[model samples]
Target: MLVHENLARLLQSYLSAGLRSWVQINVRSTNQFTYSEFTQLLPNPTITLSFKINPLPGICLLEISHNVAFAIVERVFGGPGSDAQPQRELTEIELGIIQRVVRDTFGPMKEAWRNVAEIDPSIEAVETNPVFIQTGGPTEVVAAITLAVEIGEHLGHMTYAYPYSTVEPVLSRLSPQSWLADAKHMSPSEEDSLRRAVQGAPLPLTTLLGKTRIRLGEFLALGVGDLVRLNTRVGSELPVFVGNKLVFHGKPGVVGDRMAVQITRRGT
Candidate 1:
């Protein structure tokens, strides 16, 4: 039960605040910790981040499943589908991306620790390895990112080993207490104002008729019957350029016989 609660908190940390999406963690294997192994009963692929405090040689592993990893990567890449398989083996580029993500997710916690404990936490990437496990008699593979945190040379070579289960209690103790416990206590006025702002945001008015060019002599000779060719192909969504930047891609339309455009997608 403690393991489940810790896993729940870990999942919440990743889903709500870390990756900002719903995710699940399934622990598929374990060596010594039974409470830690309970997470393997879940149905998601697990990722374990192992951390070692200097001189200990021992490590603490934070395990999360593969499904969660793919979900996180997809979210960061602004892609769809959480089940997409990562191509090839883990490369340095992929490891770097994962490191940045971990840093981003844990930056606040690290900052909080720095402020309170005055301990300078150093995170180092030791390895990004793949582990295979059998779940319900089915084989599953997961990619694990290992990081080492050196708290101090002393604590005398002591390995502060904490599973997701053990660390969860520590996390709970550190969680902030909210005075506004009810939704009713929150400011509805701010919500209404934000909604209004979103609704009132101005729509792009600029339109693109596609690329055009005119020679000096041609421009001088231009008259009412002069025809200018635009580079855009027919039936193609025109790119609306605003402030010389492509902002919207849309199909030309007509509103009450006046030329208009139905925006299809926004371009950043």
Candidate 2:
């Protein structure tokens, strides 16, 4: 769970944005469970979907309740998205609606998974009963994310399960810290964009009037009006520093009412 907390949060954000754009619905992550524990939590007559990840040769499961499916179907068809749970399996129209929802979800799902690996998931089949599906062995370990979906006034649960084997090859990249560390290396375009962004940023500049060491007692006894003699003469060009780096040489003078430095030479 320690390693997954960050990934979970990132996935939650991606899914939230994806669903909001596609269906105008909101989703919140309630909890996570292991595969064995999650299977035991499935309700009877569950809407089970088997998904296949291309180029990885792996399968996963997606589950939603009948109530949630019905609500989504209603909303997709320009209805109020409120109704009693249907007693039968999804009809052709309902299935068609759900298929679109599933297809749209893959975009964000793949993007959230990019930190781990590039996967293309497609729903192979949808089954009403979990007993009829066999995406993996009964004992296979998986990470299941439980989501609280809100469609109108009805609230429903949706679960997404990913088998450990499916993402094992890229597990090292899945950690949030690792993913963020990798993000620190920017592409040339990104670097250029960032450089442009900070080009106008302000910097503090200071002139080196000169420095002279004094005894601790002598410095402590200095008075407000006392003058401390410096090593440089009054008319000598002063080295200018920008945040500690000496970048220019300037001559000090009084401009209008304030003292100023006019740049005379650039740093070598």
Candidate 3:
């Protein structure tokens, strides 16, 4: 259940996008967890959605607090979306709306994980009692993400949990480093943006024409315009360095009135 931090970021983006599309409201994922920790975070009387993720052996859960769920239902009915304290079970219409929310959210959830996994997430059931819906055992680990949803005048939380057993199949592909490396190659626009940003950076370039050993006494005796013999031949290739690191072999030359180094070999 040790999810890559990049995966958390990806989920956040998709969750925000998915929620906005369905309700036309803001939803921000502000927290995350591994399954073992998630069990302790669950609140009583919340709406728990169990999902059967195909090809993965276990169930995943998405939980929404009553306040947030009621607010969403109220808003969908063109109400003012104020906070609601639901003391009773949801009505049939409310349940339908909640189901729609779950179904709509799956698109972005699946999209976010497309790179790491092609998860087919479908709702198995919706429950009000956390005791009845077992996300995992007390010590079981899972990847979990929490969202802060805004509806009209209220803000509430929604949490999603995917058990470690369920995600183990694709865990290797979810490493943050690997994901970043893949992202760099997958998006040409991102590559261009990176290149453009680095293009303006200034580096100190130096061409070492030659080197010679000399005593301190001989060095101090030197004067301006004095000819000092070098260890290199006139036609030899010089080593070119950028910030003290040798990057190329070049030949010292004159370019249109300016002294320059014509690169002959690039570094490995």
Query: Which number leads on TM-score?
Result: 2
Q: Give one digit per residue, the lDDT tens place, for model 1 in 161-266.
A: 2444323334443332321222244367534433443354334568877888889999899899888898988889988776678888999988997998888999
Better of 2 and 3 by lDDT: 2
Residue 159 local lDDT, model 2: 75
* C-alpha lDDT score of every prediction, in listed order: 0.43, 0.68, 0.67
The weakest ten consecutive residues by lDDT in model 2 span 1-10
Root-mean-square deviation of each candidate, in angstroms? Answer: 18.3, 14.7, 14.4
Off by over 4 Å in 2: 1-37, 186-268
lDDT of 3 at 145: 65
Sort the predicted structures by lDDT, highest score first: 2, 3, 1
TM-scores for every candidate against the unseen true structure: 0.33, 0.58, 0.56
For model 2, residues 35-152, the per-residue Cα lDDT tens digits are 6666677777777788987766567888987777887776666665445666777887787778778777776566445545567888898876666777676677787766555555
Candidate 3 lDDT at 174 equals: 69
CA deviation > 4 Å runs, candidate 1: 1-7, 10-14, 24-49, 53-58, 105-122, 129-268
Name the candidate that leads on lDDT: 2
RMSD of 3: 14.4
